[model samples]
Target: MRDGPAPGASAPTQTDMDLDLAPSPPRVEDLIAARRAKRQAILAKYSNGTSSTSTPVASQSSQAPLPALLIAEQSITRANSVAMSVDGTPAPEKYSQGERRASMSNSPPPLSAQDTAGDIGADLDKLDAADNLAFELAKGDEQDGMQAPDQETISKLEGGHDQISAADYDPSRDRREDEHKRLLGEVPHKPKVEDVMEIEEIEDVEEEDVDDMFAVAMGEPSKKTKKVKKTVSKPAPVLITTTALLDTAADAEGYYSVILGEQIDGGRYQVVSSLGKGMFANVVRGLVLQSPPEAEGILGAEVGKEVAIKIVRSQESMYRAGLKEAQILQKIRQADPDDKKHLVRLERTFEHRGHLCLVFESMSMNLRDVVKRFGKDVGLNISAVRTYAHQLFLALSLLKKLNIMHADIKPDNILVNERKNLLKLCDLGSASDASENDITPYLVSRFYRAPEIILGVPYDPALDIWSVGCTLYELYTGKILFPGRSNNQMLLLMMELKGRFNTKMIKKAKFQDAYFDEMGGFESVERDKVTGADVIRKIHLAKPTRDLRARLMPPTSVKMNDNEAKLLTSFIDLLDKCLALDPSRRITPREALSHPFIRG
Candidate 1:
């Protein structure tokens, strides 16, 4: 009688809404499981590679050593500043700026941390003691020179393109390992342009970098007028207003998608030089047909044009997630009305093969190459410093207010439009949002990391000021502020230059224990935990602050004349605050931007 229960009677149910249902159709379950599997595969494909995801953990007791000196020489290329002359011909360049001569001011060399350099007397001893005791002990015997490596081991090392087997280990090896590495993947793969002796088309190129790089750099009135060429077509009509364009594209989270490389406008475009390559993509210089072809998504206005193409290197469809980011960025054109002056404008975006191509207004050159080639032009002089620093400050001020930090600010990231006397920041690959939660980034290039970032402390936009300081230093002094060998090496240099940080700043960092233990090395260790304010202690960097005082050396000013052993000093001053370990106490971008040295 209960089996059929009353037809319309309510069925008894468990209090908490317990219920039972008929088994699902196997086909439906299979379809759902298949969809889920597909979704998981897509997710796995878009995930970031292990390359930079984890915080680097070093063993406390280990002292691994760097491979033998793999120093690569810089190439001296005389590429044209203007892609084409007004008459529609490729422009030719001659000398680069640093190769030019300049008058300088003289000052006694500041007290150096090391008394000796070239001789490698105490320095080599220190380098020997620094780390990698195993390599050091074997490489330098009592006489200081290690024995030559045997040929069999060399053959073993060179013969295999893969990892060296354990048996190949021989303390007897000297130059063999280095030669093997050089033969493998190291630079100097291409020699310095000067080493070529003779160039194919250009005649009698110089060995050293010259003061005036482009033909127009020479003071004499050139018979030829600067021809503004109109070869590259105007960028697409889409508008973008951010002072920074690529910030939205770079992922701080461990998420990455492959770039799909599709030929823009079918095969009508021809590939040229390579701009750069990332693990996931290849940025190449390309020329597209100016005329329209019967194609979909081809913006009629940009039918024939030259542009930089960034194509993802992977073959998987999951790269669509990364392309989605590019697509979103491509449509963006809005910028704060007031901040437009500081923002770089986006021209057009088109899709090819699944990959997206973004077009931007071409620039003459980045500040790094300029400084490498034309630093003398910026001068060790006060007026030149004012002009260059002023422009940089203007750019920083505008960028800071937008809550966008140029995380990868470096000489290489700054682009100069010589004709306009304007500087635009480029390379958003490492840029990040200000509101992001995971703040400790190893993202900035090796040489430009701020002290806080280096120490694994929570970082903010102030890191940019540190880079600006580094840039300012390089601009005036023609030297790198912290050309460290590794992340630890960089922090060591900062500690050596600016002293140790106090407790609070130390506490905020990811690895405070190791750093805290080392604080005893400083002169003033009161035995208290380091605070944010204590980042800079009594130990100070070599200085001639404010006016030239003893020698009238001012921040950002060239102190001595060339005949007097020229010195650029003010930049050294910025390094003090720029290197300050506390984020709260560190100079803000606006404050650094308004500093007298950068002010005209």
Candidate 2:
């Protein structure tokens, strides 16, 4: 009928005809019936404890068989057995066909185009039921003190099934439920606010041990509260020394009350004698009980050695200042490890009872004490002045090289050893970098303060030279060269000795308006004692009454020989260079060291 066949083609056979006339596709109802039959056979085999073969219907078309259903049916049967074994009871009878059919018809349609989508969904649902049944079996095994199935066995069971939808099966659901139950059992009861407040109040009461009467006597506020019902009786004030009255507790201003002969810093240092007290800190003589290993070559290391302990007030500002001083001291120590630079050495530092303590080498006395003891009103001998001046200039040279400024360089801040041979500079708490500007004008003592400071002009290391000149004069004459009660009076005294300041210097002064008129003439304000009213006074400059050399060698003083007179002349010349009115004209520490007075 179609031209017989090609040359190589065989004639049409019965089998070929049968293949060409393919049977119609299997109906949906038929596929459903076969699935139900297969599930029933699987259930019956498990129920009767016998092997039963299930011959699934084969589609005559190209559609693939659904092996997922057989796997789901086997899983369901195994789950039933697991349940029965766990509870020691038979599983319920297999679901009736009518019920199964109704459930299949009522289920939501699959969203995918695969013919087996519905079967896959049903298999997933049954797999979830099997998982739930397995969880119950695991719990039962745990209760019976039996080893449950390992993770490997469970993984095998999971691998046997098809990829199930995440919505239909969640392996972590049972674990999450168990965790929730455990967390509920372990929950702690919340404490009430009243209970918390009561506990805090108890702690506060326990910590309030300061004596109320002593606090009031010291002008400090009492920490006792109304809630503290216990009455504390006042005790007698404990007197530690004849001149020193010790407080029982810290003052409101954060000053730690000290007891004489008491040990501090874990008994490493013992308080022996009070050295002195300043605005920022107090100094006391301490006996070292424990010497640090690093203090091998440093002074104040051996046990029983006397060291000056400067305890900074516990106030926040003082603490920060103390830290800065310690840092500067450390920098100096590193720079002068040989200790040849005539600078006080800081041995170490520590904190005791919220106060910072700096340990320094103990010296016998300061230059003020030296002057008071040896010089009296007449001042130290010329030979002694030369020796002290040389050492002080050396210290200044070191400071200049380091770019440091000793803001407060008075006689009281320079110390000498017990031998009275070596002089060392101390009390650098007010020191700052020389390159820094914006420094306070009220630096150095009133007598030794530089003219630049009085004019409120930016200062440099030359400021220290001016102070050294004043100190040397005091050391030589046993008298303050310029002792002015007020800053305005000080300027007048300076002009009386050094003559009026240059007009250019006055123009550069930040406080020029206060001390000088717009015409560059000296003007000062004063309080009239009679009326207690401000009075503006204008000063007229005059030639110095006596030159520096004439002042140094007064007629009342003993006459010096020719050699001594020549030495005195050189000393006066050096002082003139140091006490220059303009900072730029002032002699440097190095130049001062090479001066004829210092070299001679």
Candidate 3:
């Protein structure tokens, strides 16, 4: 009460703040009453705390009431602290309540884990009760002083229902045990000896087969190991087999480990020097150094390991390019070993300069670079074109069998080992097992793009055939068919071949104003379907288009004789099939290989 309301406190105004402090919510009294009842129930339920085996606790309610339980928990926590302090250690279960005055007040015994369990709720309460009861019973057996019985003593506490007892009980100890067992089965046990024996029996196999597998996993041993093992190795031929289509790029000078992955002393070996750089990976010249015991004397000196090391680049930037190429090489090698009639075979993979390198027969030059420089358009007679084309098909057939696509099948990626009399299809960066559902890509140079890619149509191996057609076209006329600056123009030039702008193609291409409109009234036409977008028709195709058309004109330059022109027109016809406006009508890799132009 403030000393007589100050004169300034005058008359209260409507805007003045007021106060009325009232009693707490009636719920608080209800909660206190509930807690008192629970305390009484505790004394009754666990009147003779005692037990033998840890039987689960039984409860009348599935879930315990809260706010009342929380208050009891706070009281117990404070008791535990005070008891522990007075004892200078922990509270004794048999402490005299009156002697508790010096430190702990004349209060109840401190709650143990069991008491806290009850506060924690039904499940924990029983758990704590069972454990605490067990401890109390054991202590009573050892002490002469009066001691409380464990929960099992409840059975003896019968009769005299009106009698008051203060034994404590926490429902947590027993409930938790029953809940755990009910939710999960008995703990799992480890397998015995009999299980181990069953697994071992199944693994046992023939000794020779085991040895063969071991020898394959580990390369031929050093001389010391060979002598100790008393095993002899035979040499296989340098060229296991040969294919006219594959051109090995191996040089016989000598091969050495070039680059080591990570540190020089550890990790992978990668061939660095004497290494030739290709469209992607690094290649080293080397020889077959040794043979396995099984391979010994199998062939003559020719087979004694003189080979070229194709070091796939270990640099992360070029990893995709290298991995794809290596995967393709390994796959082809697995398909046909001795015949060499298919794709280039990888003799084996080894570490050099930290990179995993492929061993293959080497070739001197690639078909693309060779044809681009030395190929005479005038001499590109049908027979001449057929010779190259046939070799290509053979390679294609072999590659198809392995499910390998030469995604970057430009002329340069193809090689012809003249001395070895072989042609090899190489480079598979964007390639993958065709079953992977991923497209190899429009990675080829713009001029070599298949019509579908330029037209934004879905494609697959059909793209490779388009590249092949482009290569053949260059070989025959030394001129590109749709040599536009970019993919968009290439599409326009392709449309010119058809004499009109394909409306459906335009829709698919989704070009803004870049589409070349060849139709006569292109300027006056307005698209009705497209909204908020400019309907462009006339696109200025790149200048290269003009040059390509000039080169393709009949009776062309002396560099391209009539015979070559005849070959070129046919090649152009093939290119047209590959660049067909409709993807479904496009030529495929397998079918293109069978065309008379490229077939042997």
Candidate 4:
């Protein structure tokens, strides 16, 4: 009967039979087809709001569904396709059950026995290759340490999401509703390409991004490691109110000297010593590299001998004044190069940095220094004052002929040549064209400010004569003749010393009300609002008892003899003429030169 059953095998076992008769494992195509069918059924049910009692597996498979392994593979392939085509074409439209069933049934029959085994192995290899490629890409991203969001992540950022209930989808719920309504044929919303790409492209931000964000939020400076921007602040303007912008010019000890032995003016001159400093300019003694004919007389034929360089600041008002002063010097130099008796000789003018530079012939010292050395005890000798005064008047006479007004004449403005016992007027910064009628009221030193200037009357060169008279009184007595604390007090001092202003002159003054009553006498001095001091009452009560003659006399230690008295009388007469209260009657420089006091 079958050559008898093998001696060991009695009958065919159920286990063996079951194993051999089991249907072949589902093929890759079968699994894919089954999954697609399942998805289509779900979509169809959702779209039409209908459902089948049949399970997805029952509808997709004729006999039985594949094992878990095959299901997993099907899920993976479907996921990849969905991700790849997120913004691509929509999936094939849902069809009738009959058509779907036909499609499911039409999947090619299982590969032939040999081919099926070979394909399965090849597919395993392909899956492995795909897995390796994916792993490699993921590894590369890890190595870089900075990863851009994938399409799905960016879609979430941009409020792209799957279908969900309004309550569940909080991010961009309005946008979701809008999209939903568009799909429902309520409105046509054509998204722009830029709108779609906006969030996805914002990826490659580094340290610079952090800095830019910080800058936008707060005006914070960036890290030192990065490039930095530099900003510069300008100096504020000084509020100047005083007549003498330079308070230090009167005190020779107040000089702030420059560094000695410093090269300047393109190395043509070297610093010798500091001469002095003022609010608007710095004067330094310099040595010339090449001695010109003009410099030879002042500094000798020796090269590298002393000269004076006045460096004026670049403030607008001060700069224009400096340039104007230089122009005046240029005019004087053109007019008289050989006369050292008049104005200080300007050797040349140049520019240094933002300052105006004036080179001048060096002098031993200024008249103020000489006055300081004489002290208040003995005071300056009459001979010295007479010599300096004569030189000053000669200069004034020349200036008058030139139609120039030396608006500021003070002790410090006069320079002395000790070697020759000669004097010259310097610092023509306040000199003006005789035609400049609109000159500022605050021009000269307060100690020497003219009566016309104080009362704001129309003034001319006669203002210089008043200033000279005041300066000469100080030179002789080692004290200011008026020395009022303020302009109002100064007018009172003028009245107290030289008597009241002429009623006509007072009427002609622009600032008459400031100093005089309607009756043309001294106004009751009012208290300073800021200082709370009775200014006018103090001035009225503080009138000096000593006349100009008594003030100019020497101390008891230095006796005044007959010769001194005669000299003093001539000096007093000259002073009285120079100190005339009336501008029309004030002594002219031409007239002052011929007086016995100066002529002697």
Clashes of 4: 1
Model 1 residue 261 CA deviation in Å: 15
- Selected candidate, larger lDDT, 1 vs 3: 3
lDDT of 2 by residue, 1-600 (tens): 212332455674542222211111233335437645755554343333311222233442222222333343344444445434222366452454354343333222221213233343355446435533321211122122111123233234435211111112222333233223332332212223333222112123222235222121222234322221111112223322111113323455455577899998889899998877665577898898987767776444888788899988776656787898999888888877756678899988988877888999888887777767665555666766777888888788778878899877878788877546577899887788887765444566666789898787899988999989988877766666666645676787677678778878888887777676554556544455675644445444544432566456534234546667677778889899988889999998767766778777
* TM-score of each model, in listed order: 0.46, 0.57, 0.44, 0.54
Model 1 lDDT per residue over 162-271, tens place: 22211222211222232233224332111223332221222232322132232333233422222211121122233222121232232332122323342444565556
Residue runs of model 4 more than 4 Å from their true location after superposition: 1-259, 291-302, 524-532, 535-546, 553-561
Residue 274 displacement (Å), model 4: 2.2
What lDDT is reached at residue 462 by model 2?
Answer: 89
Error of 4 at 334 (Å): 2.1
User: Which one wins by lDDT: 2 or 4?
Assistant: 2
Per-candidate Cα lDDT values, in order, are 0.41, 0.61, 0.42, 0.56
Better of 1 and 2 by lDDT: 2
lDDT of 4 by residue, 1-600 (tens): 112223454453542221111121233335447655655554333223312222334343543322322432343344333322111343343344454344334222221223322333344344433422210101122122111223244335435521111112122222223323322333111223333211111123335446331222223333222221111212223233222234222223222335678776677788887776654577998887765555456533367667889977555566688889999998987766545336888877776555677888788776566656542422355665676677788778778767898876877788866322466788887788888865234557666778887677888889899989987876665555665545565676666557656678878887776555444445444445675644232122222333555444433345445665677778888998988888899998867776788766
Model 2: C-alpha RMSD to truth? 45.3
Output the number of the TM-score-best candidate.
2
Q: Cα lDDT of model 1 overall?
A: 0.41
